[model samples]
Target: MGKHVVCKVSELPPGERKIVTLERRSIGIFNIENSYYALKNVCPHYKAPLCKGVVTGMTLPSKPKEFNWGREGEILRCPWHGWEFDIKTGKSIFDPHKCFVKSYEVTVEEESESVETFEVTVELGAVVVHI
Candidate 1:
């Protein structure tokens, strides 16, 4: 386990993600409005580049084959095939524990910032993602 600095909080806003190479692995760091979540980029199904896939929402089961759309942009779809996984847990919606990708712990920290104009420097805390 190691700490890999991904990006500043301002760099990755909600509905956005960044792929970073750490410890010989490709990890996808996602910003989900209020928090950050990281997942292994490889799809366990067929070794597809999972993070490169589309980020979408989750649908809820309704009455008797009916469905409802919800949790927009909280889901991820594999690029090679249509495999849905929750971004927060890297779990397959159908079988969460059995079929899922690897999830990584993410931490946000404060960083000092330097202003360019007027040579002004301020200790502006930037959001940091650690995996």
Candidate 2:
């Protein structure tokens, strides 16, 4: 497994995401409250651009005639079929165990922790994605 330097932490602030191509594959790198997460850009259902979809929360289970919204900014809704997924785990809102999208590991690397081979703006911390 190799680490790909996607972008600087300053570039992608909290509640923001960036779609990057690494090894010819499109991947979405998201920053949620300063924590970085990476997910495959393609959606499992109908193969929509999952990363390009809306980054919002989901409606939780509520009683009859009641409405509740939770997980703010942690959900990704597919634009094509409106399929919702958990950005953190890349799991579908409905069938999380069986149906899901691929997720990658992300880490924030400081200048002192990075190697010389990888070129990134480690001074401000860089988002390194592993695939």
Candidate 3:
């Protein structure tokens, strides 16, 4: 597929997400820890807006009857089925192959053309996601 401009780099802040309609398809663009990831809005398990689901990390149990919480805002839970999927890899934690959402390649293009910071010039651009 071709590349499309979803939104500005500043528009989607960290720990937030945006649903974009492109090529007659709905895609969920997420910004996690300044990193961006794109995932098909449709859940492979079922036709659901997977992007609109909960944005929280998973729980790992240290042992039986014990639970450990880590990696906050790095996981997404389906709203309808509660299926957990890694936002970065788009792979289902429980069922890697059988269940998964399509992940798209996302890229960020800064808005500014060029800038000098402490004797260093950097080019700031916007966010352009390639599916």
> How many pairs collide in each candidate, listed in order?
0, 0, 8
User: Which residue pairs in model 3 clash with each other?
Assistant: 109-125, 109-126, 110-124, 110-125, 110-126, 111-124, 111-125, 111-126
lDDT by residue for model 3 over 1-131, one digit each (tens)? Answer: 88788889889999999998989889999999999999999877778788999999878769888889997898999899988899999999898877788899998876666663443344476554432
Writing each residue's lDDT as its tens digit, candidate 1 over 45-131 gives 899999999999987878887889998888999999889999988899889979999999998987858653443334456554432
Question: Which 10-residue window of candidate 2 scores lowest in summed lDDT?
Answer: 114-123
What is the model-wide C-alpha lDDT for candidate 2? 0.91
Worst 10 residues of 3 by lDDT: 114-123
Off by over 4 Å in 1: 112-131
Provide the overall lDDT of each model, using Cα atoms, as 2-decimal numbers: 0.88, 0.91, 0.87
Give the clashing pairs for model 2: none
Candidate 3 error regions (>4 Å): 112-131
Which candidate ranks first by TM-score, i.e. highest?
Answer: 2
Q: Is candidate 2 or candidate 3 better by lDDT?
A: 2
**Residue 125 error, candidate 3, Å:** 40
Residue 26 of model 2 has an lDDT of: 91
Query: How does model 1 fare in lDDT?
Result: 0.88
